[model samples]
Target: MKLLLLKTLLQRRARDEGFTLPMVIALGFVMILLGMTNIVKSSEENLNAITQNSSSDALAVAEVGITKYRELLNQNRILTIYNDDQWNTNANVTGQACNDLTTTPTGWEDGGTATAPNDTTKWWELREDTDGDGTDELIGEYRLVSYQYDIDDDDFDSSTPPTNNNGQFSPSDDNANTTDDFTFNDVTYDPLGVIGTSNSPEGYNPTGILTVQGRSTDGSEAQIKVEIPLRINQNDLENLDPALWIGSTDTTYLANLNGNLGSLTVTDGNVVIIDAASAGSSGCSDPADGASYTVISDAREVPSISSIASKRTEAVNAGINNSIPVTSPAVLGKTDDDPYVTPPSGATFDEDIHCANISDCRYYYDLSATDITAVTETDGIAKVTLYVDGNLNINQDLGSNVSSSYLEIYVTNSGSITIDSDSTNTINALIHAPESQLTVNGTGTVKINGSVWVDKFVNNATVEIEPDTTRISSLNTAPSYKLYSTATARTPRPLTGSPTNWVREEVQ
Candidate 1:
């Protein structure tokens, strides 16, 4: 009986051992499955990280393209005037970079076409030497998808509209209505017209918008829209506040003028009547009622002297450093004893400083001696900019022929500026002497055809001043002041929290 029990137990043990092998096999299989699952997940995570990195890179590349394009545009800007309005690159410009709109900087592809995205040639490869070993590694590529201008619909003249044929706005041929819909790259772009004239400084309206696509080597893409707004040219006198800007706040009868004020039918045209004190013995007449000139004693109208000085400094730095030494002979007899000429010493003035041949004609003076630096533009001169560090005396006619078209005088001292020329002389020049007092006491019927911005002004001379809008319009120079809109402030991107004004988005 005991032997039979042992056999039965052995059989049961054999069955139990067989069941253990199957369980172990099942466990091993389960472990293998988990390992495979983890491997797959790791691969997926790596791929996702790579894709995210590429997208980030593409976004950075898109921003870089915006900056690069802006730099190119600024460098290749060509503005044409139409009806006394500044039509920037977006307007009618011929034979220039803005002519075709397809022309780009050197090494940049011409992808301004409508199907720029499909064209592989339009891509500009972005490269950087990560190790700084000269051999640049390809980061990604970018393409200018579309460039369209936001025209001023209100400003468009239906009678004399500007033409835009094949992205070429011809100033010579005025045909196409600027407000009409223009097709570019198979897309009819609508005119995102200006806000208003009051908002625009000096009629500077918004230019246009640029769309660029940035693509990474991994096929990731990012698109950004960059708005190009109108930039204020500092040289353009239109940016100036008033025709005659007085920086002083002394309300003690500062003006004593009897000169006639007249304008060339400009926005703010008028004559002078500084009868607040007395016209003295000057033979000047006052303007009729409803004149165009402005008369405000508000201290808020005062412009900072530093701002005007900066403009003068900018011109000097831009290769206009022609020095007028003290030794230079003056047309008027220089009385060394009477450096401070309260009134004319009756000196015979017969000198003629002609600046017709020179282009810049910016003459600078650094005179330690208080001698009068007399200038008389007998011959028609180009845009002559004089930077006087001491006293300046204008005899005879000052830029009679050119008027305010090409004459600008910037005085940087408290010295006297004597206008001893007779009244027949037309002093057509823009004078900016914030620190000095301008004394207009010539005997002749002097006609001031330009603008004057001085600290203290004494109008004892019988004169006729017409605020020349041409003064600001004729000034076409560099070192401009870029006035951005409330939308885009000095940058292509929009301000935080004010996303409605400007549009910047990642389309891809």
Candidate 2:
């Protein structure tokens, strides 16, 4: 009829374009191989997140060159690690870079090394903001490869690194006969494998394995290494000694002649009355019932059996930061803006005890040796142990005053040992308070040159402190318990032990 309806509309448009152009070229070739595997997995996850963020910033720049070379060799490893011969590699072929006086300074060395620091020293740069955003971020730099193992067996041989660098490090070559100095019990330890030594400000060193390197300015050079091993401490509280003050409890008049065990308070006329007091080799006639003071506890009743006890539980566990744990009594508050220098207003008891120059002082207490700034100091201790757990009132007024030089008063107090001085005082030192009760109330006359071991002994007043074996063997050499107990004494980790005390060895 009109050509049979145009052949059925061209056969229904060829079955509706059967498979349009090969299914649009096979779905555009599988979407271009899934967009090239997501662009090669986002370019290998941005090159493995930029090689794990430049290998965690080259190991935090090798732990900031092993903590600034263990704080520039433990703050003065005997004048900069015994004169650091510069660990070879031609010393400093111009490792130049890092001056910073404030031209915009405080951390960002060019990772210097082409060498160039003939003079003008002091350099440290490491910039890092970490997004807190004050503006820092430089990431990657370190130094101190002055490696000096000369061969102690830690390995660094990188094609022979030492080169016989002779600057100084002799303990008589390691003790061929002397020089090394060790001394166990009496406490010495000079050079001998070090970790302890201090005449006060003198120095010492011994654990320094070596190796510091670090890199990664970002080109992906990324490197790192550490190996450290440092530590230090050993002052045995100067020397330690109270020689003799044996006042087991007798109360004033002069503690039974000098030696003590008590049983003498003769009071017919208030007498210790040395009526012609001259008798040696056991002579000196005088009625019995002696003791003015001086009796070192235990006649046999033994409180805790002491020859002279009470190290205050081994100096409160070797944490003795020059202690002052009064517990109450307000712990002796000061505040006048307290920079120290406020104790003498009536002075019953208050000793700041750290007077570098508290108005030109003569040291009434141990000067700073440790306790370093005492984080928050509540009377911090360790200038060699002053542990006074509590009660040690020594009311002062001593106007005669006499301490020619050399003075040490450890006073391991726990309670009671009062001496209300009125004037004319003389306590040369070595007064070990075995565990309390030994009062000597005021009106003053006190003169105890050296030695005192108390427990229960009251000497009404008028002074004491007598046994002086050549000045208590030149003032004890620190032994009889440097902190013995609480599991084998401590307080000399030397330098790198641990918060809980570690490091007899740590290779990595």
Candidate 3:
């Protein structure tokens, strides 16, 4: 009965041990799978790190290489010439036998033996004759033996050959057939020469800047570049002080002016003052409004009588004014028969005279006249004093045949000079100093074909033109900048202490 109880205890112990075996196996399998996964992940991370490091190194090397190439191109010497002839025949081989032996040997037999007999007195002569004559004859003669020894066989088999008199393989011949026929076309041989290509990367433009120490074409050691930008602004225009922009809105004046009416000051007043003539009627007057004027102010100031008279004279002389009729010579001579009546010489006196021809009359100078007519010179200088009772007219023939001097016209103490021209008639005047302020006052028009350089001030000047037109242009344009690149070489040296690598960098 005790033995049976011990047997039941043993059976229960076996059942527990069965579950323990499966648990230990499962734990071992999980440990193995976890270890393998860790190993694979660690390997992948290591590989990725190595790849990143390699890419960085490669990028640096490529950049350096490109820079080095640029420097090489920029250098003075760039190309080297090994051979320049179209058909260079210079052989680069040495220790080459000239011909084949054994087959058609003059002194060599088919067997590995010499033709000279033993103990022969002419052995030296035979050897020499065989070496010289046999080589010449064998190479010069044509044969049809087999592809191995045949020079005429287009499809010569080089794999199989006879033991003797077989054609030997020559590296020089192979090089000649493969590489020696190279011909350079349109090649420029320059040392330190620059070359360009259109294969640049997008948005990556290369430019070179060279700071040379030697003298330049201007005989100065200066900084020169292929590219430069130029800018022009309002400051530059201000410095030049062109006449077109002078004193219109940029000038200041005195604040006050005293007058006879209780010493009238010009403070905050728009009226200007006109001084009276202390002498005679030689002074100017306001326009007739049927009122007897004692003194005149800026508000009553009017165009001078002299200016109007000058313009009238100019129009009459130019044959544009028909109101003033010119009488015939015979009629004028009859009226001036007395010759010494001496008409009253006043400011408004109209003197009538007779001339045999228009050239016989002298230039009239009356400051109160409407117009005066004159001619100019071919040499661009017109010198004429115009005293206008109305308007002034420059009716001068401008040429060397008419006038040999410059055209200089003066509007002397008169009204404005009006430059008028028809399609067939044109007037060019170079006005100089005037007694009063000169004005280009006219309802009629004037045009200048050439540039006018004004060295003096023009009061109340007006330049009328068609709307929206270009006023000026550059007579000579300036140059612009450009960019270029070149390549150069650096000295070859070891990259560290090792002889395997080299050091390359762009110096400039």
Candidate whose TM-score is highest: 1
Q: If scored against the real structure, what TM-score would every candidate get?
A: 0.36, 0.25, 0.17
True-vs-predicted CA distance for residue 200, candidate 1, Å = 9.2
Q: Model 2, range 189-241, lDDT digits (tens) per residue?
A: 34445343442112322334444445667744233333343333444211222
Instruction: Give the deviation of candidate 3 from the true structure as CA RMSD.
Output: 39.6
Runs in model 1 deviating more than 4 A are: 1-17, 77-91, 95-103, 106-121, 135-137, 151-207, 228-508
User: What's model 1's TM-score?
Assistant: 0.36
Give the C-alpha lDDT of model 3.
Answer: 0.24
> Regarding lDDT, does 1 or 2 come out ahead?
1
lDDT of 1: 0.45
Model 2 root mean square deviation, Cα atoms: 25.2
Cα lDDT for residue 501, candidate 1: 25
Query: How would you encode candidate 1's per-residue C-alpha lDDT over 59-151 as one tens digit per residue?
Result: 888877776665544433332121112222233432321122333344454334332122324777777788989997878888766554444
The window of 10 residues in a row where model 1 has the poorest summed lDDT is 484-493
Off by over 4 Å in 3: 1-362, 367-385, 389-409, 418-425, 433-508
The worst-scoring run of ten residues by lDDT in candidate 3 lies at 479-488
Task: Tell me which of candidates 2 and 3 scores higher on lDDT.
Answer: 2
